[model samples]
Target: MVEGEGVTARQASFGGRGARLLLRWCAVSCWLVVPIPAVVLFTTDVPWWAGVPIQALVLLLILPIGIALWFDADQHREDTGRLLRAGRPAVAEVVELELVDPGDGSADTAVLRLRISGDDVPPFEATYRGSADPEFRPGALLHATVDPADNLFVLRNLHRS
Candidate 1:
């Protein structure tokens, strides 16, 4: 029942068309998420181009987009929190699991394809890409919370520390 006890699938939110558009915006255009760091260079006392102020123009251009994204992410976080609080319990059976970075020197993580079915909740398949925990084995039944929106679910109580 405690929050974030288990490894939750962050990809659950990337279910619909919105995420694809977000990815496209970040990839094809390079307009939205890429300018955040360039804008930072202007804020520091460090000389822009050692004499030229190229960073100034870049900052002026990208600051607006950064602000917009920051506000958007903050609001989305709030909304997701609300849904998780009101979510219903469900069980997810891992149909497949694959570790993406086994020896890459990063944290143990994997992509999990799970089939979710619960009482009064329609069955659906979701691919979860996150921390690779021992609890998430193929055919393992994991606990989760089904969002009222019926599209996303958060895993819980996997390996509480």
Candidate 2:
């Protein structure tokens, strides 16, 4: 619980960092693998009539997956941006922190658990990931922007003064 501009926020389960990574990987793999069968069929001695249909069949199977993955990624960004722009000012307290190990194992991802305050809303818990100030430890008070339409969605703009 935090004392500041009182705002309504609810706990919502949005996709975390792992889900985003999986989506990106699926999109990229679809694109990379789709061309392989086409290239192999085209280079073979198969006639144009036989090769064309096979190539089209291969593309027909994989193109939709690629397109859907891209669309999902785009939609996620649009939704998050819309929520952030219309968010109301609020305050939250850091409850926990989880460090995510990167795929290349270069650096760790910083994830924070926060408890948001609202009059009728329960003690809402939300997680944020990205770079944060060193002072943002557990029990620290932080400013946040919560979506009025959906209290479960929030954006913590910690850099703002």
Top TM-score model: 1
TM-score of 2: 0.53
Count clashes in each candidate, considering only residues at least 3 apart in sequence or on different chains: 2, 1
Worst 10 residues of 1 by lDDT: 7-16
Q: Model 2, which residues run further than 4 Å from truth?
A: 1-33, 44-65, 118-123, 131-135, 158-161
Instruction: For residue 14, give model 2's deviation from the true position in Å.
Output: 12
> Per-residue lDDT for 25-99 in model 2, tens only?
898888787777667767777787877787687688777898788777766665556555565566778899777
Clashing pairs for predicted structure model 2, backbone only: 10-151
TM-score of 1: 0.55
Q: Rate the local accuracy (lDDT) of all candidates.
A: 0.62, 0.66
> Which ten contiguous residues of candidate 2 have the minimum total lDDT?
7-16
lDDT of 1 by residue, 54-113 (tens): 545555666566556545555556545644565667788999998887787988777899
